[model samples]
Target: MFRRLKTSQIVVDVIVAVGFFVIAWPIETITVTGALGFEYRLGSLGSVLAGLVIAGLFSGALALRRLSPALALVIAWVGALAQMSLGRPPGFADVAIFGVLYATAAYGSRTVYWAGFASALVGALVITVYLTAGPMYAGGLSWQTLPLALVMLVAAAFALGLSWTIGALVRTAVRARENRDAQQRAEAETAAEQERVRIARDMHDVVAHSLAVVIAQADGARYAAAADPAVAAGALATISTTARSALADVRLLLGQLRHRQGDGPQPTIADLEELYAQVRTAGVQLRVDVDPAAQGEPPAAVQLAVYRILQEALTNALRHGAPGGAVDVRLAWLPDHVDVEVRNPVEPGAPAPARVGHGVIGMRERAQLAGGGLDATEEAAVFTVRARLPIGDPA
Candidate 1:
């Protein structure tokens, strides 16, 4: 409840209050005259005491203007009426009403703002009536009275209305700035979340596919060691290479949390040859066919999607297909899109892979995110995965 007070605002209020207190009596006695041409002249100590008391009330109210504008406005108007009752002319303390009006518009609630505005209208009417009907113009209203009343009304309204308008403009500007800041914060949060999901999917693809290759190579080396030492050594080499690539990719993904940097190198369509060789070493006879004329280079994002989709499909074949079954990979690059198809014969007795495995889901998500489509199907003892990814302007 005890928040820090604004030092600058307090300093300004104090200066205004002290200035009003010091000048209220002197300025009236020296320069200002009554509406009836009567000049201020101090007759006794009581008049001085009354003047000081009224100034104190006005100054005190001014000090709390920003803290509670409605309360300050009430106190200031009361002080103004007191000065008028004593036939005293308007003093410098009257300026405090404008500041109070500004505070109401800037910080006060809806009721307070409307109350302050009503006070302005009522105060103007009261001042005009007091000048024309009070002892200052006791001879009765004359031709000059209407103009004088109009001047008073306009002056009062202008002073109070102008301050309120300025405060309202400031309030509008502040709210706009706050809204802009909130929108930017929300956008930043959304982008960060998307990045996190992308990284998670990449990790799933890398780890799952690598582990499948490592298992296949290990199993093959165990069986081939007695038959041929060279074949076992080559299998061990493939396992080591696959494991190192997976480790490097994982490290790069983890580093993203600590620093913002390029993702180094990502596998693309050009690396499919290496992928095919790795699958061949894993004991799967792989056939890859590419239409040379259709090899127009695709965008990097599409290339990455294509590479990951193909990788995931082949990994599944290695894990679930018959040990000696043949796998076929076909690539067709078109003007606006690229199509990839991988097919393998399902093992006779082994159950077909799940229609929505985690790996398949990851592939589908990747393809769709790249503005593409993917399909996986099992029919006639064969499992097939196909994807079509948009490129260039289509992306």
Candidate 2:
């Protein structure tokens, strides 16, 4: 309840009202003289009651300042007029005018703010005329009185103008802060969307590669089951292992939805041997040649990119290339980059893969993100995937 009250605008305004009342109530004497040739003073119990009542009216008006600045300013002006009617000149109760003017400039609409500015000019003129024509000055429309009246007019204008200007400056600052926060939120959303795309690409690579291997092994097992049961058992074991690994990877990818980065290690260039063994077990003739210098461990990010590129290339070759065709993989280490090339024979009369295929798009995106480039081409029944990735610091 206390927390709620603290957060409530009405409660905060009430507290401000109470504070203004406390400060303005004790001042029973007004500084300026009235038309009666004497300074206005409230010196009796009845007069004290009148002053407190005026203070309450002013404070109550101030409490509504933020909610309705135009209304609050009008109400405070009414209280000022009542005080003047009671033979009181300018006094502490008039301080509420500053707050009301500030609210008008800070929160009021354009129509309301312009109206408040006009009111300020008019109010300054009225105060100047009233103070100069008072009985205490003992003169009317004289050169001596004119100078004092002009000074009073300028002083009043300056005071109100300062309050309004301060509120206007505060309004500008609040707008700037809100704009900055909105931009930050937009950037955060963009980052989250990019992360989701990355996860999706990773999931596709894992599932597609595992499924291709399982299909190949299942087909081979079906043909060999009667002739050699042992061979079929080995094929079954390969399918089971590949399925379990794929399931684990899928779980890790889904965990990201809950903002959890799983503790599982990411596959890297070192995992290429296992990947190669899997493809060979699926009956594809595979040959790998890695440059000795490039075999040195690279940064984790570059290694992960290399592994995904290789995995996706092998999966495509096994799925779409001629059955029992030879796949050639070559890795060359240069001074600044590592180059990977995979070539497989396309079956005769087989249509070339679509240029906008999701698998090819994912590989291209991954290569570019890793500071590299990738290209796929089909020429004379030969399919090729080539990628060049920048090498990071030795790991």
Candidate 3:
């Protein structure tokens, strides 16, 4: 929020510099008039305006205060040196000193921030020394003036220090707020990416599982129509049922894509029964066993994780297991976590599939996202996928 392009800042500073020039002109003129006239009934209006114009020119560096604080500081120093050379008393144009010092701390680079701090201390000392010794040079110097010099020094130091401190505090606040805003933006982007990944994974699971079953049933029907028409008829029925369910799942997923987060339907633990039945009708002997020990139902997020893992695992088995293989599904519920394992038979000495796919990766990611773990391995002609999911609420 504190940041601004230098191009725009330059224009703003120019306008501010003009404002300062206008205000200082009148104040400097009034001070000159009151000093020369009220004190000694002397001095012309034309002379007062001429001297004030020169002082106002020195303060013109305010135009670059924010855009280039170091440059502004340099210009301010030039003005101060000129005023001291002319032995001029304090005037409204001197306000640029505080303005420049404040800009150095609030808007400058590292070098300039510290440089402004040093200038504040040094400038106060210079002012006190110049004012104190001016009387000495005028032939009226004495020990009685030392206390007044000390008072002037203290007051000048306090004013300069206060300006720098306020600028430093503003700088710190702006930086802290920007950092917090950046962190929030990063977190939001991460959430959006994760949601996209999750949707892709779900679409893969639903379509892959349904199509695998349909293909198996269609192939079985193609070969068995003449010898046993009843077997062919049953296969077609299973294919129909699986396709309709897949179509509905796809429609729901598409709807989710069009809506805001949390507006879509989520699968839970109870959906596993229909999955097993679909696989069984594809001519694979599917067996399921569940041992319940937890007192209450799991959170929806954990159940969704468990469901997706099993769905993908069963899909893999149905597509790659040995022909007419018997798949074993087991679920063991614990107090704080649930365990799921799917085992399907393959050829006795067959090698692993030639190319690895995202099925295993997706399942592993799902488990980990739920604050748990998963493993998929093939051993002794049996492909096994095991996963554990925590029953805790979703983050």
**Per-prediction TM-score, please?**
0.83, 0.83, 0.87
Score each candidate by Cα lDDT.
0.80, 0.82, 0.80
lDDT, candidate 2, 1-395, per-residue tens: 01122348878998999998998877743344444344654557756776787888789778888888878888888887777667566668888888888888888888778877876888788777766784333455578668878988999998987888888898899889999999999999998888889888999999999999999999999999999999999999999999998999898888876764643578977789999989998989999998745655687878888889889998889888898789999998776788988999988777654253588788888889888899999998889999988887432
As for candidate 3, its clashing pairs are none
Give the alpha carbon lDDT tens digit for every residue of 1-395 in model 3. 12356667668778888888878776655433233112212146743654465456555767777867888888888878766665556677888888888988998888899999999999999888777675223423358877877898999999998898888998899899999999999999998788788889999999999999999999999999999999999999999999999999888878777884473777877887788888888888988888874568888778888889988888888778898889999998888789999999877656443235788888999999899999888887888988888778534
Task: Give the worst 10-residue stretch by lDDT in candidate 3.
Answer: 33-42
Off by over 4 Å in 1: 1-54, 85-87, 134-144, 292-296, 347-357, 393-395
Q: State the lDDT of candidate 1 residue by residue for 146-261, as single tens digits.
A: 78778878987787778888877776887899999999999999988888888888898889889999999999899999999999999999999999989999999999866856
Between candidates 1 and 2, name the one with more favorable lDDT.
Answer: 2
lDDT of 3 at 109: 85
Which ten residues in a row are the worst by lDDT in model 2? 28-37
Question: What does candidate 2 score in Cα RMSD to the true structure?
Answer: 4.4
Ten residues in sequence with the least summed lDDT for candidate 1? 26-35
In candidate 2, which residue ranges exceed 4 Å CA deviation?
1-7, 18-57, 80-88, 110-122, 133-138, 262-264, 348-351, 355-357, 392-395
